[model samples]
Target: MIRRHDVTPAQFAALAAGYGGPETIEALARAQLSKHLLLIKFIAEAWVGARAHRDAAVETLTRAQAAAPAEVAELLGSPLVGAWAADCTRRLRGGLRAEIPLDAECNHLSAIAAAAAALAGVEARLEVPSFGGRVAVPGFGLTKLDGAAVATVACGRVTVAGAAQWLAPRTLSATSHGRSIRVTLDDVDPYRGGHHVPPTGRLTSVDGWQAVFAEAWDLLATHAPARADELAAGLRTLIPLQQVDSHSARSATIRDAFGAFGLTMPSRATDLAVTLVHEFQHSKLSGLLDVTRLSDPGATELHFAPWRIDPRPVSGLLQGVYAFLGIADLWRRLLPVVAEAPQEYAVVREQVRWGLTSLEGSGALTEAGRRFTSGMRAVFDDMAADRVPPELVRRAERKLRGTHDAWQRRHQTTDSPARP
Candidate 1:
């Protein structure tokens, strides 16, 4: 269906900014720092939509993607494009409609609207594909029939078992470049057993942790509601994770605790803040991307997003990721300075260096290399400019510089074991 619409400057920027070379969601976030919430909503919807109508949407978008640029350009003014984008995102990130029965007609409306907005001068040849297969949720444990996800808008309305059983409503969305996506789980029980774990080693009471959360909240709340909301909303996602334990994660570099099985309590503010921000970024970032026309390629043969039945070239997703690295790395550099056990500065440096190695290998980093450096430096600059506290910023910067220099010396020495 073709409908008339108009694209805005902001939407145009989002389309351009979402590419991260390899880190789509992170890049998308950096591109829309000014409109973080919008970015979040966009990415989340895209991911979940994709999850819901994996094959149909992918097939639709692939056909749409293959359309002549002249026609694709027309989609900018077509209301159908936005509707499609919204639907695919839902399938990709939200639990698949097969199990949830989401109201994906919502996407038809959205794709049309966004198409009108994102493709202004271009007329898009749009097609709404029919969903007709099993679907899976990207991160959540759920599934549904082709149309069931949209049908069960009320599916997540209530939970029967423990807090773990509680379900939430959310629309997955992301920027066109896939910088990141957001999943807004609805009807959340803020106080739940999932978030209620016995404070572990080094943890005294919830009161102590609450004080830290309060301070972080105070700092976050002082900013835009968008910032506060993302901060709060991001935290809410972690509540159900076996990894609320993730908050206690400490890392010299990768914060692997959250990524794998690790149990430890946070002993430093920087560690706590960085861990929260990183996981938050991951949760949100993962929401917006179109990983495949199926569920985790690692886990299933099913596509999560609606896409054509073919190898969908995610050529741009990684491009988007490089941009995300610039942002995530900056935050990592700015986290805090604490000489806690296993959280040594040297360890962090090796981690950063190891990370840079990945960037170096990616080649996009070569083009975006300068931008990456500038972004890293910006962390300290923000602290000096008072966007962050001087004390926290200063220590973090020192740690980073120390790490960088050590990394350099190691490379100069034996190319092994990273210099001491």
Candidate 2:
């Protein structure tokens, strides 16, 4: 566990620099702080306007506090921290909601609970019943903890199942196409939902994530073999997954934390394969950014994003470009594999072009961003140089350009237009 005395700014920076690779003790300490401090900020934010949920939130915080050493607890409870949390929460509320989202509230609260359990030298298993008519156990099997807690917080109930005998987390290992990965079903991400507090309903399915993961791996092996190896090498853990139950689309791909990847069980191997590549891109960039800040801290102007409804900051633009670098590569490889599906191929081709154009327009990246992007540009150009059907290129360029132009007119700041 990371005690307050063990962490220094230099150590934290080193950890960020290492990203998620095998790190020394100091780097590991920094990783823990990076993950937990986010949760702590959320907790402090939720404490205000907790109103009806005050007891649950306070209980969650108190338990976490009691579990940690005095120094850690003081850091968590500092008045400055509370004030900061309040300010952040107010901004997050955006005048639309009175309090933080329920799932976020529960997610952070459970993070606190999990930390408390870890500090007490015990392993925890969670059972969360969502109001949405399903129950979920993110870390089902009894497993050793990684100096952190596993907790389930919902309106229904959040309890510690029992202790794991092992001292490290439980893992599932699989190999395919001569590549292997260790999938960790542990409590690593503190801000995940599906394990929520009461009054919410979620459809949580158990006993099937392994099959989905295996299938996804096979698809990668067959189609994008090289990227699969990169994934296997870069990825060390996989968090618990849930079923997608959205109204618009029945599937979702999420990369919430720097290294943590989550997916709604995908039916199509191709879908899963693309998601793996997409989220892996985020993980890689997150690790890189930890070591280096790629933009001025004061660069907070929101800009139009082709993929989003709301304006995004320079950081978000950089992240999008970095992530799409891999996405574009994945599609470039899969293009030949899905040749039979002409319509699908068209979309994939457009994605490649769109990704390239977005990277070209990715504005004013910091020195680090420019350095990283220079390498990305090399690969992107290599892919771009590949000859494609001229008709396909024309069609895709038109479609992608139309999408970007339409999005700007609708979403970009009109009071002061964005640079072309």
Highest TM-score: give the candidate number.
2
lDDT of 1 at 28: 30
The 10-residue segment of model 1 with minimum total lDDT is 253-262
Off by over 4 Å in 2: 1-173, 184-190, 194-208, 233-256, 300-304, 340-363, 412-420
> Per-residue lDDT for 1-420 in model 1, tens only?
322222233432232232122233333333222222232245444544445443333333344435444443333221112223333354556643543234443334323322322232222222222234322121222222333232121222211111123123233222222123233221121111112242122212344444454444443333223333444332222222233544455321111111111113445444454454444444333333221121122321211111112211222222223233333443434345223422332333333333433333332322333343344334423423434444544565566546545654644532322112
Number of backbone collisions per candidate: 126, 12
Compare the candidates by lDDT and give the number of the best one.
Answer: 2
lDDT of 2: 0.49
Error of 2 at 234 (Å): 4.8
Which stretches in model 1 have alpha-carbon errors above 4 Å?
1-212, 215-237, 243-271, 281-343, 364-370, 377-420
Q: Assess candidate 1 and give its lDDT.
A: 0.32
lDDT of 2 by residue, 1-420 (tens): 334333344533332222223333324324434445664555555555434344454555565556556544433332222222434454455532434445443444343444444444434443222222222222332233333333544332344334344222246555787877765644322224322221112224434656667777887777777666666655544444443344321222232233345455566666667677777667655545545566776765665555565666777766666666566666666667665334444545455445434444556567655555556556656766767777776776677667667766786534322332
Q: How does each model score on TM-score? A: 0.32, 0.57
TM-score of structure candidate 1? 0.32
